[model samples]
Target: METTIALYSHDSVGLGHARRNRALAYALAEHLPDRLGGSVRGLLIAGHPDAGRDPLPDGWDWLILPGLTRGPGGTVPRRLGGDAEDLRALRAATARAALTALRPDLLIVDRHPFGIDGEFLPALRDLRAQGCAIVLGLREVLDAPEPAALEWERLGGAEHVADHLDAVWVYGDAQVYDPRLTGELPGALAHLATTTGYLGHGRPPAPRGERRPAGDGGPRAPYLLTVLGGGSDGAELARVAAAAEPPAGHHHLLVTGPQMAEEDIAEVRSIARPGTSVVRSAADVPELIAEASAVVSMAGYNTLAELLVTSTPALVVPRTRRRQEQPRRARALAALGAVTTQGIDTLTPAVVTDWWRQAVATRCDRTGIDLGGLAVVPRLAAELLGHGASTGRATTGHAASGRRAAGRRTASRQEVRAVAV
Candidate 1:
């Protein structure tokens, strides 16, 4: 018989979680049929008010929940306060209603093991009673160890995952780092863990006739592409990048993520230099990265993965106010010489410009860091559906060839582990 998979992604704050889940769903749909003996049906249970605004792949079904939101000026709505008790109640009610309706064979949750408000537990508990296979998918980094430990404990994160989840699928290479590096994993989770390489991003082919506009081709221009993952905390960064004066013949492409306010967008637009192109989000990000001389960005995992794929020289200024995860990721990637890191507090137009100038002149081989994310999706789907490890060999043929061409840079397993943690 065919299997039904329901994915629960609580993307209450930014576009990263939802975008990642959607990419995984698409990959599962594309590969499950050939890997599994039977067909697979998929559904996305998104708990974000803005979920609809995100573009969905064709042939996917979605159910929206009453997701919470942070108010203007990055404040949580006063009416809701930050009380865990009240939030959990609301999340529980929503999850109960959705699960009762879907009755999925497999439930894959993106982060938040206990749900955004602790509401997911009841639904998850009920689903477990009914014999559902549960999996928890975590991104590589979850912020510096101390705070993460406290937060996870207070939120009952470890207990919840151990008691109810069937497996834990960490997206990155576990041989490189363990979850304990970021925070303490409840002892209960040790046996249930599995590493699936990095759950890399998927790459759809460039749309037809989508070449760079006439007169826009040739000897890589001295330009930088500046991006904020969701544009939630990027107004200042965009302004700084826009105001900088580059060397003669230098230019920039500033992509404001979709979440930026209209005023912020206008501000970026007004300050753009003659050679700068300030655009809203575009589907052709990979193409832009491939063509750019260098990239300036916030350190969201998806964006970092894409930058790695292109091996584009980069300057990463991570967002640090609301969430501290980006800064940690930035530090690690910087350690590997994959990109240069600038903390939000010290980022200035002059500093940004100088970094761009230096990055353009640097000769770093970024191929080592590009994890070949797009190729991992099909392989993950095959594994999820009981097929052996056929996906890796198929998708990474080119990457393997490239690695051979570049000559391997061998790091001890211990070094790789230290980097991952």
Candidate 2:
């Protein structure tokens, strides 16, 4: 018997969701066979075209949707020359058709449950009727409580999402950051919530092509590294970090993410000092993160996950743009001493230089946080798929008091606990 899984990422913003799903695909491929007594094959249903750039598991492939770009108010079509509604219908139909043909046994949704503008709702409903075990994969930190709640309301409340999702897998250390405790996750979601730990301490997906190392395709030993995730709104940070000087005898490598504008890339490249390196993207970012003497980066979830899993000192400059997600995340990790943080608005070359001087003097201590999300997810997938309702309803537990309305599926939710290191 063989199992098929479909990983979906709305990707309205950057490649964070796509990268995370890629990592999960790597994890699932590595661990699922041993648990399920068979091989695994999957598709990465990503919104961004570039999501397919990364290498996938042997039997896995990419299904890129018409991309959605984030803006001041909300998301819009990335490139397709049509109105939002037209694109939504097209994407919805495409996703529905693909999932119906695949008939995957398990489906994992990254972050958004219904996807951008409910593009995923039709497919999710279609798959449920086909008996697919669906899980919602959430990052450790959403926005601050109020905004997150409003956003959740916008994305359909717990009951609406739960109708389609079998489980909610949180990809963060509970001890480090619990959305439930912080009200980022409403009480209605408690019965469905399971912390998968941070997804950092796991086998990394192979780069689709050769990774561009800092210099000469090797570790720039003792070099100070700065990474801007996706580079959509990272121009200011890149400019500031590029102007800063590293500690004595240390060079700096600033990676302006692939999504960054060409002009911004050029500007950063033009201003780069002799000892500083500026590149649009790098291969095997995790490899670079592991080898850095100390690091500076944006507080994007994937980047932060990379930073937290290592002992290399890090300084996070959170994005101060529309959403408070980045700022909230940087502050949480900063509170844990996992990484130092600075407001992008207040950031300056003097601050970067000063922070780097002290940061390199000592390595970070991240032993207390849970980092085993990758290993745990396969178990959850297997358990759910194995016990899947013939009717497609999940056996996931209900909230205390069993407040579920009549006709709703309810079962005891099993919580996955993390032992502190």
Candidate 3:
């Protein structure tokens, strides 16, 4: 019988989850042929606002769900022009139909265990009842230890993993940030976890013929690239960089991701100096990374992974106001000599230009880090389905009440599965 895999990506804030899952699905499609020696199938359940943009792979297809957005408060459905209740019902029904149609032998869910708004629970329950092997995939850093634990407990995330998951794959190296230690992952679930190293931005997708570069009507020239993921809260960073004085002969490409407001994009464009261009999106990031002399970006998991794989020397300005995930990841990458880090509190045009020069001059060595996760993740998936090592026991348990034995609410969340040495 052919093995079928279902991947669910519940993306809210940015394109990270969607992009990562897309890469995983692509890799599986490419590899399952050699591993299984026959036929394999894949289904992707995605909700990225940009889901319609990217090219799809062969032997795999995606179901686009109603989009959602997240804020300091929580998540709310997006793109429905009618009543919120009606949209929610439509979203629920869509999720059910997609899962039932796929009826996969193995289910791999990104991030949230119960999924955003618990929309995945019904399908998860259905799959669980059929004895389908399920896996929860996590990035290297989620947030600082304390708040991450609190958020997980509050959302009943850890309990869900313990109860319903067959395995937990952390797409990172433990030497960087082990989830068990920093994130305070519960021991029971921790036993089922595996660190699959970060996934690489494999060969850039071939552009449809006649594609021009960042500038008007020509191939894009080599330039310094700046990507402020999703661009929702990166106006200040974009504004400052666009206005910065660049080294002579250097051109700039500022990609203010899809979520950036139009007003903010206009503002950045107004201040953009000569030889600098502003774009709302990029379909082929790996190609852009290759064309870039250097990169400046936030320390999001997907972006950092790309930087590491491309060996692009980057100057990272991590976001630290409402969340600490980026800052922590930036510090770790800096310590490993992968990328340079700068604090937003001390940012200035002069400071940015100096770092830009440094990045342009330096060539990063990626020997110390792992970029084999593009392949590792698929192997892990195969293993979960009884093809490799048997996945550890993952019997379900009662949902956590989001509290310790005490009645008090806990504070903070952590991303490390084990303490880094």
Candidate 4:
């Protein structure tokens, strides 16, 4: 029988969660038809009403909810412009109605389980009673575990997720950092935890005849490309990157993510020098990375993964205040010699410029870093659907154990050398 996966992405504030979930949804649908005897359909339940308006794949559907917003300290903002109780009632009604209508075989809750507003609880319970497989699609990091556990408990999130979720697919490699280090995966759901490695969003191939021209009229010499993952917390980085005067032979391309405010965009534009271009989001980032002499960016997981694939000489300026994930991820990559990292506290214009100069001069061979993350997406889809075995074998032959599979293929030639020597 065909499987229908309803993905609940309660992304009220930033583009990262929603964008990543969309990628998984697309992957599931795209890969299912070929692997499974029946097709896969996806329905995305968006907590942000405005989110549904974004373009989605053809087979995907959306159910918009009463909007939620991110408040101080990354907490879900309470309902506004209506009585709190009345708003909760209304949201509950809407959520229940939507769940009844969709009736999916699988429920993939992206990031959070209670749907941002605690309004999806009843619906989640009802779906579970109907035997729908409830899965939690968590990104690798969730700040710190103790604080997350307390907050989740306060919000009744931990209980809800633990009681209902059948699986928790963490989109990261556990060898890097344990998910338990960031959140309290309750004992009830412990057996369900699966490290799917990193489900990196794959980029399209570079277009034909799209080579960057050469010379002063050709591609400008030694230009730095500075980007913020979603631009929500990138004002300071944008300013620092924009204000830095490039060396005589260099230029800059500053891409502000779509989430950046207009005022911030204008501020970046005002700071742009003669050799700099300040653009609001572009579809050709991978192309830019491929052609650029170097790149400077926030260490968002997707960005870091892309850089690893391109092996582009780059520096990671991690975001620290919003969450600790970026810093940890950046530091990990730096440890691997995959990229240089500018600590969040030391990222002044002068410091950025210095790093840029040093980075441009550095000739680190990034060929040692693995770029095979994207190839794992199809494999993940097959594994999730129980249709194919992962190429790697479990170290202990038990799924519940926290060990990685042995005999996994290595992407870099260095891994081969390590194995050989």
Candidate 5:
């Protein structure tokens, strides 16, 4: 029999969660057949319609919920123009309906555990009743420790996490930067966690038989690229990078993502040096980064993942307006000589050229960082679902959760909380 899977990524913010789930879906489809001795099918459930644009496994599809945008206390309807509570209920119903029918053998949830407003609670209960293996996938950097604690507390803390999830996959290499050591991930959930390294490397482009994803096809080689991951909060970084001069002999192309305001994008284009290109997006960022002479980008998880796998020299200007996650990550990689860091406040075009000149001259070395997550995750999923064994590092085992497997719990006790952090 073939294994079935479903992934849920809240879409109130940028497409990072959805994109990460899509990448994992492709990786699982490519690798799981051998372990299962058959095939795999998947469904990616997301809040933004843009989630459907990305390619998936041969038989997999997408379920995009009502769009949402961050508001005062939590997420609000992006365009529905209705009450926030009503939209949350609608999204929850849609997800529950889809999963109740799909009955996936495994459910991999990215970031948000209970979904927005506890949307996944009913679906999780439904899947749990059917013995679906539930796993929470988290990016390596989850902001500084203090705020992370309060945020996790809002989500019902470690006890709540344990009550719902069977395992936790931290998508990063602890050797490069460990969240546990800094209390970003609490000790209570440590026993059920697994470090899956970065998911940016080894990600195959456009699933088989699918057309290539939409991008600008990127500029020619020996050129520098500047990109803002989501562009929602990247106006400052976009301006900085747009103002910076490309290396002496190379061209500079600034890609302002779609989420950025139109005025912001226009401003970036206006100030861009003559002969330079400023667009909204690219079809293949990893491919573009591989061919760049050097890259100037904000230090987001997805951006860092793309940087880590290749030998490209990048100058990361972490956004520290709200959280210290990006800055912390940049500093850690800088410590290992993997990449260089610059705070957005003090960064300037002249400083950019100085670093770009030297960085491209000597490409970065990421020899020690783990880049095998695309291969390890399938094995971990198979093992978690009782099909095979883990092929990667188990930061800690699920021995303590043996009791969890013996019982099923509903997430009713935990009131739905805000997911804006």
Candidate 6:
């Protein structure tokens, strides 16, 4: 028997959802044979224009949907270059068509259970009737509980999760931030919630020994890596960082991201000193982070995951305007001694200059934390498919040999790198 796994990432603005789902897709493609005693295939259906930038496994494929975005008050089409309603219809049709063709054994929906404007409901019903196991994937924190509850209720979110989803996986630890506390998990679907720790970006390229600062001759020019996930709301951070004085010998590279406007780039470049460099993106973000003395960025899921694995010191100025997810996650990480958080209001050039002057190592205390989520998710998926045990970590008892074999296969494949696309 062969099993098919389909992942839906309704990414509108940023690349977080698409990137996280892609990681899971690769992991599952490698581990499915061990758990199901059969061949496996992975399919990613996404609306992100840059989804094609990620590397796929041998058995993995993807479908790019019409890009759709949500505005302040309502839903709007993005990058469709055509009528909004027609594009939305096209996106819905494409998703349903993929569901029909793949007939997946398991389907994972990222972030939104019903998807924006209930675009996924028809497919959910069809998949459920076909006996497919559906799962909802969540980040550590969504907005604050009260507002989150209201939004969920208004969106009919609880009904969708309870009726359609077989399980929910949180890509974070419970002690750090619990979805239950946020009231996002309805009482009926509470049992489906499982915290799978933080998804790691494998090992960083820099050797662990080389991660330490230069020991000789006072403070050498530390390399400062500045990134803001999508770069839409990151102009201020980039501008201030470009103008701010670096630590004694610190040179700087500012990756404003692909979504940054031309004006924003020019603005950051206008004040950038001779040694400062501004790039739209990096080939591999984790590698770039590994080479940095420290990072200044927003508190997005992928960025946080990379920081955790690389054990890089980070100064996060979370975006907390319409959404509190960033700030909440940042504060939670700060509580665990993982990273430092600052307010955008206070992110003045002087403030950043003062902080970098003293900021040494702010790496979080990772003892006993779950950075193995890249491995744990496959185990959970196996359990949901009813062919394996439901252990929190990857099975290591009788399945240890299988895991080792999977590791070899993973190593032989292209090196796993986080793409900001």
User: Which runs of model 1 end up more than 4 angstroms from their true locations?
Assistant: 54-58, 71-94, 175-177, 182-184, 204-222, 361-364, 370-421
- Give the candidate number with the greatest TM-score: 5
Clashing pairs in 6: 221-249, 221-250, 222-250, 338-364
What C-alpha lDDT values do all the predictions have? 0.66, 0.80, 0.73, 0.66, 0.80, 0.76
Question: Could you estimate the TM-score for every candidate?
Answer: 0.79, 0.89, 0.87, 0.80, 0.91, 0.86
* Residue lDDT tens for model 2, 1-421: 6888999998888899999998899999998888778999999999998888777879999999998786566677899866887888988898999987887878899988888888899899877765566788999888889988898788678767777866788898887788889998887675688887889888573455566653445445679898998998899999998988888888888888888999998888887766788877787778788778888899998998887788999888888767788888888888988888888889898999899888888898898988878877777676665521222222336411122321122111111112211
Q: Estimate, for each residue in 1-421, the C-alpha lDDT of model 3 and write its tens digit.
A: 4777888887767777877888887888787656655567888887875765666576777788887765455566676555545655676688878877666767888887776667778888877765576788888777878887887777676765577877778888788778777755667667667777788646336458624444444324557888888788888889988987766778888888878999999999999988788888766666677668888888888878877877778889998877788898899989998888998788887888887777777677877887777777666665545454323322212112211211121011011112211
What clash pairs does model 1 have? 88-117, 92-119, 176-417, 177-421
Per-residue lDDT of candidate 6, residues 162-267 (tens digit): 7776677888888788887667666655556777888884522333444322322212246788888878778888998888887767877788887889999988
lDDT score, candidate 3, position 168:
79
Q: What is the Å distance of residue 243 in model 2 from its true position? A: 0.4
Which whole-number lDDT from 0 to 100 does residue 119 have in model 2?
86
Model 1 lDDT vs. the true structure?
0.66
The best-first sequence of candidates by lDDT reads 2, 5, 6, 3, 1, 4
Clashes of each: 4, 4, 27, 2, 3, 4
RMSD of each: 10.3, 7.0, 9.1, 9.8, 5.7, 8.5
Name the regions of candidate 3 deviating beyond 4 angstroms: 71-73, 81-86, 201-206, 210-222, 389-421
Stretches of candidate 5 off by over 4 Å are 206-217, 391-395, 399-421
Task: Please write out the lDDT profile of model 1 over residues 1-421, one tens digit for every residue.
Answer: 5757778887767767776777677677776667666777777877665555545555567777655666564324224567545665766687678776766666888887766656577888877766565777777777667776776777765665577776666666553445644454545554455555554446443455544432344223766688787787789889988877665677777878777889998998898767777776755666777677788888887787677767678888888886677887787778877788888688888887787777776545655543544455445444533454543333234223322322221123224437646
**Total colliding residue pairs, candidate 4:** 2
Comparing 4 with 6 on TM-score, the higher-scoring candidate is 6
Tell me model 2's lDDT, rounded to 2 decimals.
Answer: 0.80
lDDT accuracy of residue 348 in candidate 5? 81
lDDT of candidate 4 at residue 311, scale 0 to 100? 48
